[model samples]
Target: MGNNKSLRDMQAEVDQYISQFKEGYFSPLAMLARLSEELGELSREVNHFYGEKPKKSSEKENTVEEELADMLFVVICFANSLNIDLQKAHDAVMHKFNTRDKDRWTRIGEEGEDENGNN
Candidate 1:
């Protein structure tokens, strides 16, 4: 379950897996709903583990890590269905954050200076 596969590889893997099914991929709206559902499940796990809420004995135990993987699977499926390259998307997002929001947070080591020596 744990590997160093890139986003492109993950997308291909999901595509291959979904290709075997007669239903292939769901509509974007349905996938969006599934993504939301997975997010809710992840949130519930977080609340149960970190917040005041505790799981009852009758409830099935699920780890936050597992919930995150479930959400990732749905995301990969959504991206594959839409012909979107998540690697490029991730790179664009990182570039935006690095440039537009670089100064939005405080640096760890120095005042008014980031780890990359940018002031």
Candidate 2:
């Protein structure tokens, strides 16, 4: 959810930010560990908001969107270090989903109306 930039553009921005640092991207293992940590943070937020669990008064609150952005930054760093194009990766997965699950779910308008209660 960056404004309007493509994934490639986002990758370039991440690269520029990382380039300023003396130590660039972390090792792959470290990147994975960081991703896991961010994911856990996001999960905790989700649990507090939507699940039975409640956040403790001492705990700080973070939006799910912010946690997702943090994870995305780490992922972009990982992909940039490996010279992988996330746009291509995302497209390939979307292609698979479109082909393999073309009819797996019903469309909102297929039932003669949109999900928004519109005609």
Candidate 3:
């Protein structure tokens, strides 16, 4: 809809995570650090799950919420910077998926599977 997203939009996208954050709940710098931390955690989890990295002692302990929060915070921030509504954007994407992919991907899972019940 616009040429490019703005910094304020990014900030708002991220800030949307804190539904009731107080004035002192966080600072810009803190949010940046938290985002990086969450991204790192997610990367580590992915490596443990599907990459070559061996699992850490706490590897099984997934910080899914932390990662989600971090992602949403940045997303809201980005959206706010560009005056984009996440709810609307998300809905649009879902609508597209529902209409276009419902049938396209429905049978993709069997592409690699054997046919006629043969292995």
Per-residue C-alpha lDDT of model 2 across residues 1-119, encoded as one tens digit per residue: 36899999999999999999999899999999999999999899889888999889999888888988998999999999899999999999999889998666777657755555467
Q: Judged by lDDT against the true structure, how good is candidate 2?
A: 0.90
User: Which sections of candidate 3 miss by over 4 Å?
Assistant: 1-40, 49-52, 55-62, 107-119
- lDDT string, candidate 1, 1-119, tens digits: 35899999899899999999999999999999999999999999999999999999999999999999999999999999999999999999999999999878886676877568778
- Candidate 3 achieves a global lDDT of 0.62
- TM-score (C-alpha) between model 1 and the true structure: 0.90
Among these predicted structures, which one has the highest TM-score?
1
| Superior by lDDT: candidate 1 or candidate 2 | 1
Worst 10 residues of 3 by lDDT: 17-26
Q: How many Å off is the CA of 26 in candidate 3?
A: 14
* Residue 13 alpha-carbon offset, candidate 2, angstroms: 0.5
- Collision pairs in model 2: none
Q: Tell me the lDDT of model 1 at 19.
A: 99
Q: lDDT scores for all predictions?
A: 0.94, 0.90, 0.62
Regions more than 4 Å wrong, model 1: 111-119
For all candidates, the clash counts are 0, 0, 19
